[model samples]
Target: MYQKSLVELAADLQKGAYSSEELTRACLQRIHTHDERLNSFVTVTETQALTAAQAADAAIKAGTAGPLTGIPFAHKDIFCTNGVKTSCGSRMLDNFIAPYDATVTQKLLAAGAVMVGKTNMDEFAMGSSNETSFYGPVRNPWDETTVPGGSSGGSAAAVAARLVPVSTGTDTGGSIRQPAALCGVTGLKPTYGRVSRYGMIAFASSLDQGGPFARSAEDAAVLLGAMAGFDARDSTSVDRPVDDYVAQLNQPLQGLKIGLPKEYFGAGLDTAVGDAIAVAIEEFRKLGATVTEITLPNTHLSVPAYYVVAPAECSSNLSRFDGVRFGHRAANAQDLQDLYTRSRGEGFGSEVKRRILVGTYALSAGYYDAYYLKAQQVRHLIRDDFLQAFAQVDVIMGPTAPSVAFKLGEKADDPVSMYLSDIYTISVNLAGLPAISIPAGFSNGLPIGLQVIGNYFAEARLLNIGHRYQQVSDWHTRSPQGFE
Candidate 1:
């Protein structure tokens, strides 16, 4: 039951091959038996999940169930789930139970998808390695000592370990795709505004976009169909028609022009990972796709620009949590100012504080022009570079991360090294384009992901490209030895 893709699981449920209650119990039992070693979930909603499954079974019997009916999936902790602890992997909201559901949560519930639990993540979605999580790092199922990439590591790990068939994730500077790369699953980062942001904890509002993590591209397409749509409450969500992503998954890749960014193959990329990417490209060529080298001239500037822009927005968005309205508060405050200072200083983790300080300084009056403004200018140039490249290419292909999963503590102390892990992915967020990472091959027993990035609102096309690749390869089907 756990090995099936979401589409397969849905089919079985529709055919009455198994009950939703039985599948939900299987997942819960797996979590009980194995998640202690993985630390993947922050809260498992056993009673709630069982109740939802029962309702789904009734709906199916009544001849009124959706595609996602009774399919259990995990939600990233960043999204608010009414009555569940919506900890964004931080002490600041450890006790904060959201009173309302996030738009994503509401949509999935309406589709009759059962929520199993909330997955772990980097605190406030700040770090590349999952180590910044206040719940402690989520260990990769492939190798427990290594960090599953973050801040979506727990969701990625859960999908990879087959604890759940699919899960929700958000990509703000590679949060969704990076961890999926390290954890060896298919992860999609939809175009900015493709999914609503209402009730999702903001990281960098402009760069943040909610997406999905699944074992295969077909599963991702099914999940994204339910998650993508216009929502009036979120001012940034685009009022565009959602495509039938699942219907287009089997589209052939003939005549597809794939761009290989010259910058992506340069310094710092591991040879093993690069070789894996090359093998994946050859597989595409056999499928009748043409590969061409393209230059995204501003690719080198993405990391610095993202660090500046993301933090600036995070600093602004996180200001709402300073003990005034919601989130953590200090006991026995001397005054208002004292309350704000101690609440924030005590609630936020070290990495969150570091980013907050950096963002505050960048947005300060004197430094605003020199830092924030310059970063925005660079961001525009990066967007322009992608726009230019897309004119000749159907999609851009490259390595998702520079290498396979690194040791848990390797880059924890060095923020610069950690920031560079997302070098290939931040530009897509800066440009507000859709992108995906799929398992290409392995490097020293660890998986390497090949990224397929498309122009704005090209998620359906990207899904087709990934789905075609998965049809010819078995990497995405492979699971951790013991877990399998």
Candidate 2:
């Protein structure tokens, strides 16, 4: 049951091949038996999951079920779940049970999906590796010593390990796509404002977008269909009608125009990963798609610009979590100011503190124009680069990460090197465009992801492209050895 794709599982449930309760039990059992090895889950709601599964079974019997009914999936810890510990992988919120559901949580629940657990992630979504998580790192199922990528690493690792067929993740700076590449899964980061961000703990409010992780593009499409829509409460959410992501999954790619950026294939990309991407391109060509070379000139400035912009937003959004309100509070203090100092000092991890400090400094009055304003200017250039490329091509293709998963501590001490892990992805967020990462191939047994970027609100087109490639490829279907 765990081996089946989400689409397959949904069909099985609808056909009465297996009850939702039975599948949910199998998933829970797998988590208990193997998750300690991966540290993927921060919380497992066995009682609630079983109860939800029973409700789903009743819905199906009453012939009132949706596509995701009875499906068991995990939520990234960053999304608040009512009555569940929505610890954003930070000690500050370790004991904070959410009083309400995030918009993503509400939508999934309405779709009849059962939440099995909340997956671990980087503390405050600040780090490139899962090592910054307060609960400890989430191990890559493909290679335990290597990172699964962050801040959505746990969600990616859980799906890769088959602990769940599908799960939710938030990508602020390649969190969903990078980990998906390392874990050999299909992940999508929808256009900004395409998915509601309400109730999702903010990292970089502008860049943080909730998405899905699954074994195939088809599964991602199904999840996206349920997860996306206009939300009146979320001001950032676009007031646009949602596309039928699943309905377009099988659209032909015969005339697809794929643009391969010269920068993406240049220095820094792993040789094996580049070669894998080359082969994947040929596969698309065989499917009758035309490939062309393109340039995103401002791509070189993406990393630096992202650091400044993302941190600036993070600093502002995280200000609400002071000692006075909910979350962690200092045990005792000499005064109110001291309480604020101690609470934040003791609550946030080193990486989180580093980002917050940098953010604060960038947004400081005297330095605002020099750093924050300039970064925003560079961000515009990056967005323009993508706009120009999109004008010439239907979609842009590249390696999701410059390399395969690195050893867990390889870049932990070197923050610059860690930031570069998202070099290929940050530009999309800057442009607020839709993108998808699918398994391209592996490099020395580790997986590589082929990123597909489309114009804003082109999620359906992006998923259709991914689904077409998946039809001819088996990379997404392969599982980590022990888990299989």
Candidate 3:
């Protein structure tokens, strides 16, 4: 029952093979059994999930349930669920319980999806590996010592371990795709503003967009359909009509032109992972995609530019966490300065502080133009490079990360090395395009992911491409051995 995709589970639900209560129970049981090792969930809403499952069961009996009725899924802890602890993997928010549901959460609940739990993430979505998380790092199910790539690490780990069929994740810079790559799952980062951000705890607001993680592209499409749409609450939410994502799953990719960015394939990418991506591209060629080498000239500037831009935005967005408003406050304080200093100094993790410092420096008066404004100009160039490449190709493909999962503490000492893990993914956020990462194959026993990047609002095409690849391969279907 746990092995089935969300689409299959939904079909079985409609066919009366199992009740929502039973499905929810199965997921809860799995979490109870396996989450001790993976540490994927921050808070398991067992009572709320059971109650919602019962309601879904009632709706099913009444013949009014939607397509996703009774299907179980989890949300990354960044999303604010009314009365649930919406910790963004930070000590500051450790005791915070939101009074409102994120727009995405509201829509999914309305579509009858059951909430299994809230998954773990990096502190304020700052790091590549899950090590920055205040709850502790999430272990890759593939190998217990290996890290599940992060901010969305818990979401990918949960889905990959089959604790849940699909889960929600937000990507500021590769938070969704990179973790999906390491955990061997499917994750999508929809076009910026396509999915409403209301009530999703802000982290680099302009770049943070939430989407779904699932075992297959079809399941992702189903989840995306329910999660996306215009939300007046989120001023940036595009008012365009939402498409039936699942309806477009069967679209073929014949004659599609896939661009392989020259810079992505050059030095620094691990050979084993590169080989796996090459094979995946070859398979696409066999399926009738025309492959061409393209150049995203500004690729090298992406990481530096992202560091400057993302942190600058993060510094501003995270400022709202001052003890007076909400979240953790110091137990003892002589005055406002003491309160702010003690609260923040104790609340944030090392990496979070490091970024806050970097961001504060870049956004400061004298450094503003040199760092922030310059980074913004470079960001424009990066986007322009993609625009140029897309003019001649239907989609771009690359390895989601340089390599597969690394040991838990492997890069923790070096922040720059950790930042580089997002080299291939940050550009997509910088460009504000749609991208998806699917388990392509494995290298040295760890999962590797193939990144499918589409033009603006090209989620349908990316999903179709991913669906085609998944239809021909079983890599996405393979689970971590012990978990099954």
| Ranking of candidates on lDDT, top first | 1, 3, 2
lDDT of 2: 0.93
Off by over 4 Å in 3: none
TM-score of each: 0.99, 0.99, 0.99
lDDT of 2 at 185: 95
Where does candidate 1 stray beyond 4 Å? none
Tens-place lDDT per residue, model 2, 280-397, is 9999999999999999998989999999999899889888888887899999699988998899898999998888899999999899999999999999899989888989999999
Give me the displacement of residue 125 in model 1, in angstroms. 0.7
lDDT of 1 by residue, 268-291 (tens): 999999999999999999999999
Which residue pairs in candidate 1 have backbone atoms (N, alpha carbon, C) closer than 3 angstroms, thus clashing?
none
Report lDDT (CA) for all predictions. 0.94, 0.93, 0.93
Error in Å for residue 68 of model 2? 0.4
- Give the Å shift of residue 315 in candidate 3: 0.7
Give every collision pair in model 2: none
- By lDDT, the better pick of 1 and 2 is 1
Report the candidate with higher lDDT, 1 versus 3: 1
For candidate 1, the 10 contiguous residues with the lowest summed lDDT are 475-484
Q: Put down candidate 3 lDDT per residue, 1-484, tens digits, no spaces.
A: 9999887888888889999999999999999999999999999999999999999999999999887899999999999999999999999999999989999999999999999899999998888889999999999999989999998999999999999999999999999999999999999999999999999988898799999999999999989989999999999999998887877887877899999999999899999999999999999999999999999999999999999999899888888877998899998799999999889988899998888899999999899999999999999999999999999999999999999999999999999999999999999999999999999999877999999999989898888889989999999989988886
